[model samples]
Target: MSDVQINKTKLTYDYIIVGGGSTGSTIAGRLGEKSQNSVLLLEEGPRDKSIYIHIPVTYYKTAQGPLLKRYNYQRSAEQTPQHEATMVQAKVLGGGSSVNAMLYLRGNSSDYDDWEKAGAIGWGYHDVIKYFKKSEDNNIFHNKVHGVNGPLGVSDCAYKHNLSRVWLKACQEYGLPYNPDFNSGEQQGCGFYQVTIRNGRRSSASKAYLSNRRDNLSVETGCKVLKLIFEGNRAVAVEFIQNGKKQTAYAKKEIIISAGTFGSPHLLLLSGLGPKEDLEQYGIPVVKDLPQVGQNYQDHIEMSLVYKLKGAFSYDKYKKLQWQAVAGLQFLLFNAGPATSNIIETGAFWWSSQGKKLPDLQLFFLAGAGIEEGKDGVPGGNGCTISITQTRPESVGYIKLQSADPYQQPLIVPNYITAPNDLKTLADGAKLVQSIMSQDAFKDYVESSHVPEKPLESSEDFENFVRNEAYPGLHPCGTCKIGKDELTSVVDPELKVHGIEGLRVADASIMPNVISGNLNAVTIMIGEKAAELILNS
Candidate 1:
């Protein structure tokens, strides 16, 4: 049978899922499992067909290339007055899961427990761990915390750079223990990251869940959702544009907005479901006066400490044409080589201060420098970077509609490093990175610091360095957060939009607070839990 296409003939479905990203794809796939219901998934971007998305090492191309949407944002005036930063988000079908480094980290268990304490009822660690296990198909672990038959594949890196292994050893030598699993409720230690890859191919949400051809599921790409149609206090349909033609699709059961942190809140504001004053200014008809629709934004901010390497040992060696050809040939013939590595294979978690019970800092060791955009490599061409991130930032930002026009991008203000603690934590993390590099394990490979060019001997110097160099971690969350009421949050614990029936926001936007690690794994767990909630309802 032909896949169902969005047309005048079929304008209704049992469920309408906006955005074919991680959570949206999971919900649509789960709901479409039942033969009694039909699902329609609309994605604003094109299908996930790019070659850079599947290759593990080449994912940086997609992350820095045209597949992403860049938003120019400003930091808080008090912290860095008039300072502008660029935030990039995935704009493809599978979202970040398709473009990310594919690290499978669940963060610390206390992160979800803290969520319960913060008004996200039934979202505690114990309540949510099952969902995490349900979404994971681990290749190494088979226990209560991991699942063996799940759809998403989690495995060790097919190829690891020698520098990554050396870095791991250096981390252990620097006083951190070697932790085999970071997802086992405790997150402090250095180790290799298990990625979302299988047999040298990326296993994105679309690949894990939506790859099966199901008659009940209809996925439409390049469909931009303009607004939601409502009756009284209930959402009934969605108005979108596909191939430049305006169309309306009614929902029989519910309309889930899984458009991610920025997209979800942007859609709500466009549909007039935000603060009354803000909506009125945009000339939009107010449907619900939810004050916190685009408020309480949170994200992780990181600073990279780049160092020059003594020899051509890092992945930067592949910058030459001959090395690229050799690696490409190995990948094509045997599916094994440097091309199979994600580059960011090893990392660690630790506390910035001595008293903290949980680790406030996360570190990623990149074997090559100048990999990400806007970052500079060493002059001699061989380098490495130790990116230190302030895991839980107190700095909050927001996303607001620029105008009433749906085509215009939203105003993103990620007010990063406004919190004093965040800056101090990152400064301390930089000291720790320097300590790790100074260890005897890295003595043979280390040349000199490329970023600072001088030793940071005092607190003021580290703080100054952080102020000049820290950047967004690109893990945006908590915008349309889940909370006790509509005044402070957009969705409830059940992922339902408050004060509006038949509507829910099931993406990272619903996170009460940003977790300590990457958002992809936890976001997928949210999708699994959301599917269960919808199915049980």
Candidate 2:
């Protein structure tokens, strides 16, 4: 990537974008295409230069590494006794795209349709598919739903473990049909996932959008924006800290906040654009009293079922020095091996209960257990994991300002599985996965369950397991939702902030509801659509 420093004297630009993440990077690249439009992108984190950020298999390390910022969360008081739950947000130029497993899922088409029905006009499946295609450069499947010449690269996994293939066959033998493409708008059935990897390296938003030198676009990293500088409800500038020095930058035309789900709403609340009572409590003068600014939080929650393997058939064997050396040499020589795999490559989508029109559960089959932090391996040191996720959860939460300090982490409450239906759906999904793993196809490879440790013979067993073991899917969104008015939403259909002039929000935070799949692809699509809206406006 080019290292073009921002001129201290020339701090004004036509468009100023906060947060150089997936959405922010895309907007900067697209808006900079027009030389007349000067765009400035500011990221609080450093540049995406770490080796871990570029490799496909280093996701496990980068996910918990310093490139991410962890925020402590909790369930509501009525749900259970207070316990510590944590969620991580990206803190690099490419955001989650730089650190995530790189799964390229757009969710079921009905997800966008549901967004449209819920007041996000002009955002239905048909309306938003073009944007999804607009940013993609698929190495395979040159069809209407996939794009070929876009900056972001989408390709099939270069390597898959033998056990991963076996899991796919077992899912099919258990009932699901093989799905060739999940991004084709139909997300049901078992299949291998396409990823955001190109040439065996991660195709992060920073590499895709900001790698090329653009004279019109200037990206400044390690700059933490303190607050929006408003002039009579018009956000014209931002005051921030850079290199331990406070600085101010002016926007000639507009300012767009693309700070993801948590940061975006936290920025708004810090800038006095949220609930009047909450702002007053923190001594922040109310600028818009938009009650929905930090409300309507949503996320996907998942629970894993781990099973021991009869032998060293999975990637767990590679933890040894000899196998690690072999795998390293294979990748360095031919760009292939276990190192080329993203680990969570194969997955399936199906209903948690019968007679449901759409699938409410998504399952990911990992070739090795104890791969991710907070997970365990079996006594024999050979195991695999199947994680079941509730795709469309009914539970809602919020993000509130912990204090007036911009550096303080926000109060994040995902309230995961607080809703009765969410718990039931997850329990049902676990049962379905249990049945799939029990199929004869897995008999040669599997031994016994290692997580639940015992057979869950009753509904209560499943429910208790889900409640105790469920974790965040890391797909947080909907804090700054899009809708028709200020009473219920933070931004309008055009993505412009309600009642605030010259300010817009374009990120996953504006999602009316969380999609039924991963958020990275859809978040990039939002950046594509947001740029178009701004250009048209």
Candidate 3:
């Protein structure tokens, strides 16, 4: 294998952030701002200058386009008894941000409170609320809960896609109250979704923090990080490969693994830092016997209840030039059109009548049916979908190293819908969605529900359907969980990995438990908070 030569004489730096997608980019930007410290950001993909990534609607085409390389981590058909196919994450520079549908959900306040209850200290809703506001530049609510100016822009979607007014009407008709903003102090009602778009384009974390500061940071895209270089237990460097050539770079101060839930843990195990037996099988010299590095993988699973629309409201116009021209003109002038919509999600947060506390289920009212698992995270095509997900699932999954080589894909066993309660919570959410849809308010929009449209006659029927067709919410997290115990937790409360120095994880991987809603905004906030902690420390 070809190797890129680097002198250890020039290896010293203040910090080195790996996986420059969402969190990595933010950490690098924030650290680079400190003139006293130098930072390097290494990404395993192309440079962050894709025109398609910037344009929100154009992103739909780019997600599966040629520019985004496929990097699905496949498991043996025998290994994952639960899953029948391979799972993938974006390999391009922006990571999942380049491929994920730009839905900007901040999760719920109670979700954070639960983390504290789970023993992740100092992570209460009240503690992190300021950080949430600190990272947001909300175009809608400039209240005490939201910030007016921040690096991360959280705002009303750039477009008012069709079905906005109708969606709100359908919610009220279903008795699910209309909520103007979900990110405000209280999040309890159905409302239009806020997207990570600015001026009709996708405003990914890379877009927000990676640009305009290239000179100070060294970014390595199209380079797969192989492993970390350790000396007497201190992580001193990182080894990577690009264009079929191996390369090595050192971090004088810190080595942050922001390579998502799968990549980060997989890299750790390959570096001889996970379960000892697994490392031995892979012929990796054991560095640390951390048994829980890849353990506790969590994701939100949902079953989409499809619906055939009543009229031309479906994205059928996407193929026609007349509508395309009109959408382009609308966005160019006002940044308000279907092109800017991340699809309006109008629904509710109601209990199952069984729960005594806040609702643990979220009901999404998508305007159409989606088919086929495409490269883009967005569900395919125009059919309304109601996704019933477990508010808090007790089941946990894991990621493991398949080989010592960095090019080799890791083993991702999501073990989705494993627990009996996970299935029950989903059924509860689905029942709520069905009740709302059956209401008279949605009569104008409701033509008919497509699959399993009628009321699920029995619990067995609901559970059977959910187990068969349940899809991932694309909010995978918690492999590198944080807590007080070093035995089970990967990162401590300060985001530092126990028994490891000069290393920290700054992504959704640090979530103690998966949040109730979309995790993109939460991950971004984690990035900001990690940076703050590092700077202050």
TM-score of each: 0.97, 0.96, 0.90
Candidate 2 residue lDDT tens string, 375-415: 87788999999998888999999989889999898988887
Which candidate do you rate higher for TM-score, 1 or 2?
Answer: 1
Q: How many backbone clashes does candidate 1 have?
A: 0
Off by over 4 Å in 3: 1-11, 62-83, 353-356, 371-382, 453-455
Candidate closest to the true structure, highest TM-score: 1
lDDT of candidate 1 over 1-537, digit per residue (tens): 223345655588888999988899888888888877888999988899999999899866876888788888876654543556678888889989989989998888888988998899999999999998888888999898988788898999989999999999898999999989988878889999999998888989989999998888899999999999999999999999998899899998999999999899999999989989999998999999999988988999988999999999799989889999999999999999988888899999998973577899999999999887678779899999999998888999898889999988889888788888888899999999999999899989989999889778999989988988888898899988889988878899999999999999999999989999999998899999999999899
Supply the global lDDT for candidate 3. Answer: 0.71
What is each predicted model's overall lDDT from 0 to 1?
A: 0.89, 0.89, 0.71
- Per-residue lDDT tens digits for candidate 3, residues 40-159, read 788877875776666666655564565544344333221223434544456666666666667676777887888888777888888888877777777777877777677766667655
* TM-score-based ranking: 1, 2, 3
Worst 10 residues of 3 by lDDT: 371-380
